[model samples]
Target chain A: MTEEPKPRRLTPKGRATRDRIIEAATELIARNGVAGTGIEDVRAAAGVSGSQLYHYFDSKQALIRAVITRQADSVLHPDQPRVTALDSFDALRAWADAAIERQRENGCRGDCTLGSLAGELSVSDEESRTDLATGFLRWKDLILDGLRAMRDRGGLRADADLDELALSLLTALQGGVLLSQTMLHVRPLEAAMNASLAYVHSFATTAGR
Target chain B: MTEEPKPRRLTPKGRATRDRIIEAATELIARNGVAGTGIEDVRAAAGVSGSQLYHYFDSKQALIRAVITRQADSVLHPDQPRVTALDSFDALRAWADAAIERQRENGCRGDCTLGSLAGELSVSDEESRTDLATGFLRWKDLILDGLRAMRDRGGLRADADLDELALSLLTALQGGVLLSQTMLHVRPLEAAMNASLAYVHSFATTAGR
Candidate 1:
């Protein structure tokens, strides 16, 4: 397992600079892809010196891994509590709606931040692939927690395969988001999430209802 | 609409050279993505002179378009008839199986060739995005044909929303395949296809059964 290099403690100003570098790299990569965006491009975009970049990240791969982490953080941070506290079908629907709304707000141009990176970086780099997979697993775990909560609350059938259901929902979201991004429409994402929710609903108990 | 450049009639040797260039570019782009793979790289990989490259393709965008067309063809060629002739539920299952087997054979490294390109190329290039959307529509249309056949044959309910179901299935597939590729496992794909088939099954009439 390749661990990310730990950064030394830095001044508050240095922390801001590091954050700027990451944000700039994320934008560049989100637009041009990992292989397409070079270190120079990131440097120019972030307005950081070469040494400054080195001060933060040891190498390009490390920076990319950090980007993946950052993207995952961005996705989870806003909805972390709601996502984990998904105790009802209504809560699940709300989460799905927010995702669709976010895509619409962005013109449905870019896919899930982690998904876009995964599609490009997964094939070539092992460390990056592992990081991405871990990132997805984190996302999955959150939804899984919600599903389990629903089960515990007598919302889902005892026989419901929560793990499979969770994975299916995530798969649906990834696929829906990809098509929506490519087609520049929200219909596909809406359809996918609907299907996934319906799948979960299939295992609903009377008590849950 | 931007039209593909018309090729002057080529001798057999010229045709082979053109094909060689396309194949090389496809491979390179598949590995490194569109923005990462340069004209010079394709030229070297294909062992063609700069003049030869320019003669065959007016620009790098032209070659990438050709590659997209080629990838679309590759996907449609083997299963085109079967996919369109999805006259039975068994046939639909067979199609799903074939897709999963193909992914397994490739070790789940490359996703739907066109899908991978769409994820990277869709944002930056309008022409490529349109071409890719067209390609996906073609794929969806084939599945739609199959579903319609089932409905007509009384296998599905008359009121079944074939278009929404088809789009949902395709979205499920894109998501499933994307996850499978990223995780290097076929489970996500399998789960997605299973859910899609089940969705179709839900609308099946007694006669269809």
Candidate 2:
């Protein structure tokens, strides 16, 4: 094996070009919206000639679809080994803190990938909807898995309904984010997160532990 | 003197036509989204010809703005008993029940004007954003006023931060609604609402008594 761990040499330059296209697309979409973000704008941002862009992604929709896939990584990015070690209250609190901090850095502005997906919900049919749906499902799964592990570790209510509760927790945070963005105050998010943690703790109470 | 309580001949026929135009527009905008809705489509649905549609609302944007105003009424409609009798826990429960039941009818389906507003936040400019902001401020006022009574009546945490909490509660519910609609199920809403009630009871500290 070469010193660089033998990178997959299947057109590394093409892969880099594709990434540039997506990075440009992400920035444009966030500011101008799915309706307003045009392919020409993305081309200019990527600093690539028109033909170079077409060489990477076939169309604007294709570029957006790729950008969306890239967004899924943000949803569960930085997932850690401690993910499975959530056998304590402090651990859960830390997880909530990490999540809140992630959104806080942006003050939740111009990051409308999720918003765009929602805005397009009724307008976009099968393929686009699936693209949005996949992002949500993955977010749900990651949290559900984390909660399930906590439940098995004797840190949760023996009868805690992890699935329903996880759904509630995520939804509350989402609404809280909207409020935070609108009011330009982060307290709504903090409040929602606290309430959710309380709910989880209520169910996580072992009969005598 | 004119007979008191005599309903003005306020274009009774024209009034009915005007109402129909708005009603159809509301449903379409909620389900199809603002940009996706067409004036011609609203006219066909309302059974009002082109000039008739224009007679009531100047344009599709005007009609959509009217639909948004109507949506506010749908939430605060029939106006509660000035205040839900805060003398007992049951009263708060009743209010919660009313809200949950209302949300359940469509389970957060169709035009959440606030969600619709936020959905378009990236691209919507000053005027339309102001229209949406006005509706939200009014909605929050209704809830804040209602919660304040609970505090005054000694039925809630006397020191409870009513405004912040109200904003949080509303935001959480909307978030839950968005999630429920996304999941194609209402469990998330039910859980979030239940947790809200529990929070309310905790504030009262007769604690679900």
Using all chains and alpha carbons, the TM-scores for the candidates as numbered come to 0.89, 0.80
DockQ of candidates 1 onward, in order? 0.54, 0.36
lDDT of 1 by residue, A180-202 (tens): 87788888788788778888888
Model 2 spans > 4 angstroms off = A1-10, A54-56, A79-88, A98-108, A113-116, A122-126, A206-209, B1-15, B79-113
State the DockQ, from 0 to 1, for candidate 1. Answer: 0.54
- Full-model lDDT for every candidate: 0.79, 0.64
Q: TM-score of chain A for each candidate?
A: 0.92, 0.80
Recovery fraction of native interface contacts for candidate 1? 0.51
TM-score of 1: 0.89
* lDDT, residue B136, model 1: 77
Candidate of highest DockQ: 1
Q: In every candidate, how many clashes are there? A: 2, 1
Off-target runs (Cα >4 Å) in candidate 1 are A35-41, A44-47, A78-81, A110-112, B6-16, B35-50, B78-81
**Worst 10 contiguous positions by lDDT, candidate 2 chain A:** A1-10
